[model samples]
Target chain A: MKNIIIASTSTIHGGEYLEYLLPELSKHFKNCKTILFIPYARPSGITHEEYTAKASLAFAKINIAVKGIHEFENATSAIENAEGIFTGGGSTFVLVNELYRNNIMTVLSQTIKKGTPYLGTSAGSVICGLSMQNTNDMPIVYPPSFQTTGVIPFNINAHYLDPDTQSKHMGETRETRIKEFHAYNTIPVLGLREGSWLDVKGSKILLKGNLSARLFRQNQVAEEIESETDVSYIK
Target chain B: MKNIIIASTSTIHGGEYLEYLLPELSKHFKNCKTILFIPYARPSGITHEEYTAKASLAFAKINIAVKGIHEFENATSAIENAEGIFTGGGSTFVLVNELYRNNIMTVLSQTIKKGTPYLGTSAGSVICGLSMQNTNDMPIVYPPSFQTTGVIPFNINAHYLDPDTQSKHMGETRETRIKEFHAYNTIPVLGLREGSWLDVKGSKILLKGNLSARLFRQNQVAEEIESETDVSYIK
Candidate 1:
């Protein structure tokens, strides 16, 4: 059985970092005294120490200890031994690169499959998918491969935004980008909006949030899955 | 001398494709009877014939002929012998993949260096940079390498957008994405706004159009380069 939470973002608008999801996370990571944090994403290029401290403070509210994978000599062993694992958001490219460089992607997948509680946000959530092809993050750095943990059957587009009806910007909208992704990929993509998350238990994946999620599949119209609906069939 | 027009976009908010840049392109490609069109970007998955027809329709106004690279038996030779070259906008990842797949990345650079008038919009302009690290397009496909033609000294972030003060979206802003790129790479980046373009002639790179482009450098505050300014010194 697999237990996981893939969140669209770590924070919602006007909310403290991870504060909006603390209640849910508390339940998901319950019975866990400590959680190993993978801070390789390093949003805004923050130092590993600085990123870990933020995660530590957030987890403190849940009365859980937080430790970074970097703090240990063996990251693969760290994943195997972690009671719960949380990968924070930042640059998906950087996160994927570090995961490959550490050669712990396989171990991380095995850890989650073995029933260890797992949580991912933004770049973190994107890594749970089959590929990093649907990521919205800039390719700030080239990763050795676009491969991820394969904890989930499909890909994720985190922090997905709807087209602005009044905007004048000429950039492709979120929907357009996903369509382009579908042009070359057969994998289904879930456009996870901020504040939304997918609750994974065993073989089931459910949408957990107030808002609906946009599901994009090849050769089909993009459909919005209502909150709390089972989306495991997206595979 | 290298002659190129690296535009931020092919179409403005309310203009037809390439309509805004026609006058400038006409002059830059003057005396060139025909121009080679690389439709590899394939915006919205439009086929080569369809995309080429669109380009042909647009170039008709300037009395220039359009031909897609796919029509040629050898894409490498097509680029090398082109009188003028225009690479349209779409997915940068796809364009780069096709360029490498066709084994023309080196020849494309050599062709442009030999002084064939060239024009690129969005993804095309991005490849003219040091790397595609600054592209805003989604990575729909994986390319052999993120390396591109080093025609320009800096990377390009086409369709560059400003942060919306009133928007509630928590996604990383364009500025934040670029700063993240700077974390792992020291290459300079230019955020070229819609309707703005770079006039690259000889060793001079001048910012054209009415809008001021944003220039971001590593470990330094981003600056706004006024239109018509000689920005060749950025190198």
Candidate 2:
């Protein structure tokens, strides 16, 4: 039994971090007094303490305490005993590197697999895939491997954006990048846009949010999957 | 004398491949009759032969014969004997991986440093730097290392774009992403916009083309350097 929230972003264009998803999160963590926060993906290279404190502020609104995983000397034991877990956003490379460097990939996955009430955003959501090959972040650091937790079965292209109709930029569009990803790997990639998320409860995974997500598989044209649709059958 | 042409992109918005730079390329190649093409980047994972043909068509416009590195029995020997060299655009990870896998990284750098006419666009141009950390391409595959030729003292963010001011996308802007890169690396990154390029001759590396490029340094505000400016002093 697994319960999880994989969000494309922690914040929307004009919203506060975790503000857009508080309603769902409140219900997801019902009666949960505290949650373990993993700040390995420090967005803009923010310190773990500062990132954790930021997450704490968001969780505080829901009356749930948030603690940084770094607080524990034995991180492995901390996960083993955690009732809930949350991984925040940052560079996926750093996040995955730290996970492998700490030797916590397997245990952390197991804890989440056992239904530890998990939540992930941006880079954090990316680690839920077969590999972090679809991350849009710069390769600021070299990771031990691009491999990540395979809990979600497919990879996620978080914060996915459509091609700007009026832009003059010649850089590859987000859709084009995902198509390139499919050219090499057989894995399906879910283009989760900001404000969109995957809500997983047991074997059911629903596309949650007001917006639709683009799904791309090897050799297939990308298509939008509407919200509220059960995507558990995707894998 | 490291002679090189590092282009931001092979194609500009609504322009044919190499169209915007054909005039510069004609002069860059001068009297050269043929050049070796490195098609390992293979945008959208096109086959070596297919990608090579595409390059041939573009080079033909300038009356230069194009040969794919893969067509030769020994790729290194091809580089060693190349009158001119061109690396095409695609996935930076794949390009770097292939360069290292074929054991051509060292020889390729040596050939360029020895004054062999060289051209690199996008992923190709990125490998001219000390590392491929600043590439905008997706990490569809992981290379053994992120190290590149180090031909230039800094990194290049190919197809550099300004943030969409009126947009609502929450994904990090190109500028913001580079800042994140600076957070971990001290190397300066030159944001080469589409239609812009670096013209390297001997010890001088000049920013060429019609538009200005962005220069980003660690812990500092990024600034725009006008076209034709000799940025060799950036180091």
Candidate 3:
């Protein structure tokens, strides 16, 4: 059976890194003694060691050891033997490019699907979907392809924000961007706001957190899916 | 000589389409009776005809006629022979994809460089730079390349917004995203806030509007350039 937690963001506003999700994550990875970390996204262009150390600190609080996949001689073998996997948030382009460059995308996906515990936040969560097309991150780098694991039938738009009525900015809102994605693709997209996540166990995928997620389907009006609702039927 | 007005956005918030730049555009396209419009960006996923109609309505105020490039038999010829060219705002990916697909990118760049008056807003404006890697739009569609015209020496982060101090959102700020772009690219990037624009005439590129634009150079601290400042020296 597969076990996964796809969070919209690793940290909430004004909170320490991964502080808000520590309790839930501790339970999620409770059985695992050690977890492999993928830090290729490099938010703010931090080095692999720096990002890995940050992850290790968070996982340490839960009594689980975290190791960066970059430290291994072979990424595939590292993932294959890891008790659990955790991919942190950053630039989805950077993360996807590294995944392709290292040729570990397939192995990583297979390992997770084969009952390895997994936790993905932001860019990590987006990769669990059909494609990274719906990500809000800037295209800092060009990935070979937008395709992803397809561990879930739909796409994930992490850190989704609602349109601010009082703002005077002319940029497209989150909903508009996802709507445009639907114009070019038939894949469903879930707007996962910060602090929200999906708890996927075996064949069941349930929405977790306090807020409702906006679900966008091709040619249909977007609607809010309440928390605790089963989102497996989204596709 | 190049006569170009690359604006951050076509319309300011609560303003009509192109309302903010009508006077400047009136002078920019004064000698041209008709301007070729590229509506490939298709904001809101509107049809080319519909988008052209919107542009036509705006240009009509300046006694100029508008025609979408899609109406022509050959996109290259349409751009090469155009008296003035205007590419409206929307998804940058869609616009760049169409430009490459129609094989008009080079011709368009050459036409503008040959002193044909040009006006680009939002996505159109970003294409005037080295690459579209700094765009805030979603990757609804993937272009063959991230490269753009390089008419300007640096990249343009169009419709740039400052960090909201009161917001509880955990998403990366515009500055952070641009910093990540610098990690992979050496090109300088100008964060053009809404209502700001660049007026390029021959070798001189002057910042227009009343706001200060944020300039990000590789490894250097980002600084603000005041309106009317010549930014051509950036590169």
Candidate 4:
């Protein structure tokens, strides 16, 4: 059975890092004394050490120890041995590149499938989907491929925003970008708003948290899936 | 001498398509009777013919005929012999993929260097840089390479926006996103605001329009460069 939590963001507005989700994460990452942290995303270009420290402090409240993957000599072995695993958010490109570079993308996926508890936020959460093609992050670095863990059937557009009716900005809205993605890809995409997460246990993926998620499928009207509904059949 | 107009956007807010830049474009492409338009970006997934028709409609106001590169049997030759060229905005990934697929990236670069009056908006202007790493568009498709025409010395963040102080969204701001880009790459980046553009004339790259553009270089604080100032020396 697979156990995972794919969150839209690590921090919500006016909240501390991972503060809003600590209660849920505590339950999600329970039964583990220590969890390995993958800090490759390095949001805002922070060093791996610095990013890991933040994750460590947040997990400390849950009485779970946190160790960065970089601390281990063998990253693949680190995932294989971690009681639980959490990949922090930042640049999805950088995270995917590092996962491929460290040769742990497959190992990590296997570890989670073997029933190790796993948590992902933002860029980290996006990788749980079919591909990184729907990510909103800039291509800070080029990865070998857009393929991800595919633990879930569809792709994720984390930190998804609704169109601002008052804004004068001419940039494409989140919905528009995902529609463009559907133009070339047939994969379904979930627009995961901040504070929302998917609770995956065994083969069931439930939409958790307060807000509804926007589900987009090829040639179909985008619909809002209510929280706590099973989205495992989205594909 | 190289002659190019790299605009931040093809359409400004509440304005007709290319309406704001018509006067400048009239003078920039004055001698050309017809210009080849590359509709690879295809905003909203419109067909090449439809996108080209939109461009044709816009350029007609300036009395310059427009033809899509897709209309030509030999895209390379079409770019090589074009009296002028215009690449419209859409998904950067798709445009770059089609450019490489069609094997016209280099030929287009060489033609623009050989002084065929050229114009680019958004994704098209982005490719004028060394790489397409700085675009805000989603990676709907994978390209052979992130490398693009080095017509401009540095990368470009087109349709650049300032941070919104009132937003409650937790997503990374445009400024934060660019800062993350500087972590792995040292290339300079210009945040061209909507309605603003870069006028590339030989060795001179001048900022045009009313607004100042944000310039980001590695290990340095981002600064705003006033319009009408020469930015060719950035790199």
Residues B113-227, model 4: lDDT tens digits? 9899999999999999999999999999999999999899999999898998999999999999999999999999999999999999999999999999999998999999999
**Model 2, position B113: C-alpha lDDT score:** 90
RMSD of each: 0.7, 1.1, 0.8, 0.7
Give the Å error, residue A203, model 2: 1.3
Residues forming the 10-long window of minimal summed lDDT in candidate 2 chain A = A164-173
How far is B122's C-alpha from truth in model 2 (Å)?
A: 0.7
Best by DockQ: 4
Q: What's the true lDDT of residue B162 in model 4?
A: 94
Residue range B111-150, candidate 1, lDDT tens digits = 8877899999999999999899998888788898999998
- Deviation from native of the Cα of residue A3 in model 3, angstroms: 0.8
Q: What's the residue-level lDDT of B17 in candidate 4?
A: 93
lDDT score, candidate 1, position A10: 97
Q: How well does candidate 2 match the true structure in TM-score terms? A: 0.98
User: Which RMSD does model 2 reach against the true structure?
Assistant: 1.1
What is residue B230's positional error in candidate 3, in angstroms?
0.9
lDDT of each: 0.93, 0.92, 0.94, 0.94
Worst 10 residues of 1 chain A by lDDT: A140-149
Per-residue alpha-carbon lDDT of candidate 4 for residues A1-235, written as tens digits (9 for 90 to 100): 9999999999999999999999988888778999999999999999999999999899999898999999999998999989999999999999999999998889887888898999999999999988999999899899999999988889999998999999898989989999999899999999999999999999999999999999999899999999999998988
Which fraction of the native contacts appears in each prediction? 0.85, 0.77, 0.89, 0.88
Instruction: Using TM-score as the measure, name the better of candidate 1 and candidate 2.
Output: 1
Candidate 2: tens digits of C-alpha lDDT, residues A1-235: 9999999999998899899899999999895799999999888889999999999999999999999989999899988888789999888988998999889998988888899899999999999888999999899899989989888889999999888788777778888888888778999999999999999998899999999999999988888899999998887
